[model samples]
Target: MRTGRTAHLLFLADATSVHTQRWVGAMAARGWRCTVVSRLPHEVPGAEVIALGTGEGNAQWLAAAPRVRSLAHRLRPDVVHGHYITSYGFWAAACGVQPLVLTGWGSDILVSPRESRLVRLLTGWTLRRARLITADSRDMLTEIATYAPRARLEQVYWGADTDKFHPVAKAPWPFRIVSLRAWEPNYHIDVIVEAVALLRQAEPGAAIELHLLGGGSMEAPLRSLVRARGLEPFVHFHGKVDEDRMAALVNQASVSVSVPASDATSVSLLESMASGLPVVVSDLPANRQWVDAAGGFVVPAGQPAPLADALKALLREPRLAEQMGRRNRATVERQASRRSQMDRMDVLYRQVLGWTP
Candidate 1:
């Protein structure tokens, strides 16, 4: 009976990130009022974006907390939600809002805490401040438990819009591969390029095309590596794209590759799966939760030869790839559909505010 009243959510998150956009967009579509406070430049359709700081480094992030609390005081939102445990999470905590919600994106809980004792303590401070906390993976939840032993928590997938990402009729024998991760060192984009070089050698007769989506500081180095490996004609860099464009490119491919050095459940990986494309991913504990032999191949991170070998196997067997794609789609429908995850979030919001019809 959530028909009459509306919940207004104030979020502190990356305005440019598609993940943040999905959260705000979904809630907005449900007729809830949404406002985002971000340092970055971008828009989440249907939600208001409040720019903070100069859109730069760590100092700006740290300096914005007091201002954030002031904003919270004025906004008086029904829920104050923070996306990213180490940064905005701190601000959400400082605001002293009732029913504060914090979501620990992968690196914050796993990588950042190990940076130093100060970071570890700060992370704990944010976790302890929130009435409800969410993470996309079990390992993330386990790490959250370490920081705030008694914190209430939930597993919430960023998830894929199944309709947008679902398989499209394509050239049955298409020899295209797509990588949607950022061109960052941790993501091992170079390894994917090197593996593609190996894959080219393994399948010299076939016309293999590798498409790299998204961008970062590693772009110049990755392009140089592609040139050095003589894969210029085969690998295409499309930079960052909108959801519609991302879905189009993903559907145009025969398979997807995402071998990051570390990760939680990736929205890109889930989107690729929904598009009915077999994936070759890293052997991370989080990846193991989603990809398996029936769905995709998992290889050691930063190892080109093994990754290339996995890619080669998929390249040779279109039928096997197609079968794997089906398995992946089924898995996503059962576990990572965006609509379902949004429903879970809706329930979480109600529980947090004690809302009823």
Candidate 2:
């Protein structure tokens, strides 16, 4: 099949997510004619918006398929790219689209596949049908292979905007530990709180503060954990902030923590690395890829004692943390920059469609 001159790309995503917006924007910036069909109310600036009728899961596709088919007929896109493979890709492939590219976003391959036979079968179907598949981490790529052995899967790390997140002059604060993830169960914010409490016990006058950003269902539970652990004074919940403010906040932190129960590739970890902050992350496969001995410390998941030890060690040796932060930032520049990720994605897209450019 001859590839079309103008690549009409369709992104299927949950309406409110920034990931979809970022992907659409990035593709648009590269001059690909883009359309995003989402359950979101607000439309992205540069793409044609098709509002999805249902919330999420397989049932959503029943309502969304006709709308997607209508758009497919109208647009006649060369490639139909689904953002979350299990949800959107299943529908797109079931609709019989050509040159389908399915991108697996973490939990779909890692956690969702373990739920039930029905979900696993559906997810497997999507993976099998896609002409090409992409995952956010090498770990995720391996996980997806377990279900779809013959599927062509590539690891495409979620890139960070290095221009937006970079090193700033060190702040005069004593010890500021920041977390830029949602207050969700998988994130293990409770572990962070416990670690903070332990840090306080060890160093009574340790001028350490924990900054929890983003919001989720776990906010109340996390707050209660903070109070119960006597971390009310040391922990500050900033809710959610805009991208610019978030970058600033991350740059101000002495170190960043991401003690998730499990993760494929965390955008928060990449963002913190880009901002030149030393990270104390879970010793999961995903985190290990980013946090080497030089960049940051990787602690065993769900263990607050070791996490506290790592945090306290960083706090005690500010210069070592600073050096590690610089290394982390360098790693981001070399591996996780937006340009590098987009370049890999563009190549993959072209390969799926058999296009030279």
Candidate 3:
């Protein structure tokens, strides 16, 4: 399925994820024939998604292997890449394709493995079959070393589109604080809400508005909590927005927050910084790697008091916010450019396909 310029990529990933779509679109735009095989139906602007129509859990994934292998036989893709090593990676490994690339996205490596010894063993088994392994965070890559060879692994960020996410003219009035993460417990959406409440309590009539973006299982609970705190007027739920809209929201904000309990490098954090907004993130190693002292604050993982304090510091000093914003913009451009990272991936793909530059 080679297009004579780039290799056809058969991706085993969650079709619903923006990360998976972006990967598919980027490669397709580069003249590669891309097809995604997934459990759910979804679309990419320039690629194909083949829904597996199976149930969730280990059994379904195991059950879907024959069909996935059949697709590979017909497609004859130059590379078979899988995202989220625990699920899709398992099927990719089962299919026994050559030049396989498995990407361990955050929790599949960091959190999921700790669930049990069998999960870790399964993770390692899936990883060993890959020709190349990639992850966004250094900590995730470091952890991947325990399962697979360090030589085959690379740190590849799910980068932010710097061009599309540049800063826009924003007002201090309404003082919007956007959280780019979903409402899942992994992201601790309630913590951000609690911090917003604290901010209003400490300084009433501050005109602060909390924008909660992305939808998840915790929506009902979070909404109830917001109502319980009497933050209905102040808190807005923007459930599951597209990339363009998400960027606009980020650009219009005074600040951004992402307090995920665990994450690889966050695309939202990068996008926020790219849009020249100083971010407040959990004190995870991956978060620290990006949000340096100048970029934003690193508060305790689950504590709202420290997060509120960080927000207060930024809101109180416009000059300081602008300074941090400048620093953040510079940092993202240097290290987290979407184009540059994708180009790096192109090189890796070329190498795997044994194509000379």
Candidate 4:
């Protein structure tokens, strides 16, 4: 089923990001041969997966560059696309591949720049070697330019499956407010818990419920916080649901909340918009770029009181929440459609590979 002329795309990333799975699946649907090489296994069907090892960080990558070069030569890839500019991109670039597309995923540009001198230098080297660098948001692109001004940078938002996530009839019983993100410190799930507790106190008789989906290291701590706060009846944690179930849960929610400490572009927020749910998000630049006053409420970060007020306001006014949800859904239809994102990526990939679309 493989054609000799089919572009062999090597996706370099960590195993955790489902965005890689989505992109690889989309590319495969378009008949491109995709192979994912990373530290962990991906659950995507029809895409070839090769786990290069867990501890294969920059140091290991530096030493294994020659081996990776040999593998690349044998595979003879048409384009090597790295999914995280700092780590994976560094290795991909050092392995001597042409038409290298480096994709900077949030923290690589935002947090990594503030890292040690060695990391910054390595990131710079990776960016310099890239044929083109793609970021998920304009904020991320701007951050990346501080280090690699000469590199070709493109802002490509992670595409959400509108068809899968579109508006559904709200589920009856227990009005759900969901947070679908990794239970990491950066994501600030505990903040959501605190806010939800405050919201419950404000509306004592309200049937409001908080649904948390996804797993991470912070799960234990978050759970302890929930128990300590006596939010057992109101808060439910459904750890890492499949896409279908996740979409269903999104559809069931009256409002979706994400109070990230920092972000480039959030796939969860985009998906929430696509699912036609009103959002209450942190007022970070990245979130503000996606959600405005017209679409969702953007509150200050870390403070649970303001966030609780926003949630309570939305809950008190059902019509307002519905209107915001409709606007959010419309925004996704206009801007963040998967087809549009894929179209842009296709052009960028072709340009990098010197192929005519």
What pairs collide in candidate 4? 214-240
C-alpha lDDT score of every prediction, in listed order: 0.89, 0.82, 0.88, 0.83
Give the Cα-based TM-score of candidate 2 against the true structure.
0.94
* Candidate 4 segments whose C-alpha is farther than 4 A from its true place: 1-4, 54-57, 171-173
Q: lDDT per residue, candidate 4, 1-357, as tens digits? A: 224577788877665567888887788877788887777776665578888665655677677667666777777788888888777777788768788888888888788767777778888887888778888888888877877456578888886789889898764447689999889988889989999899988888889889999888999999999999999888888998889999888987999999888888888899999998889999888898888877779998888899999989888888888889999999988988887898788778887665653
TM-score result, candidate 1 = 0.96
Off by over 4 Å in 1: 1-5, 54-58
State the number of backbone clashes in model 1.
0
Best by lDDT: 1
Residues forming the 10-long window of minimal summed lDDT in candidate 4: 1-10
**Residue 96, model 3: Cα distance from true site in angstroms:** 0.9
Whichever of 1 and 2 has more TM-score, that candidate is: 1
Query: Would you estimate the TM-scores of all the predictions?
Result: 0.96, 0.94, 0.96, 0.95
Tens-place lDDT per residue, model 3, 1-357, is 344455678999989888888888888888788899989999876888899889998778777889889888888888899899889988888777888999988899998889978778889888888888999989998898887553388899888899988887777787889998888998999998999899999979689999989899999999999999999998989999988999888899999999988998999999999999988999998999998778889998899999999999998987788888888998889998899899889889888877745
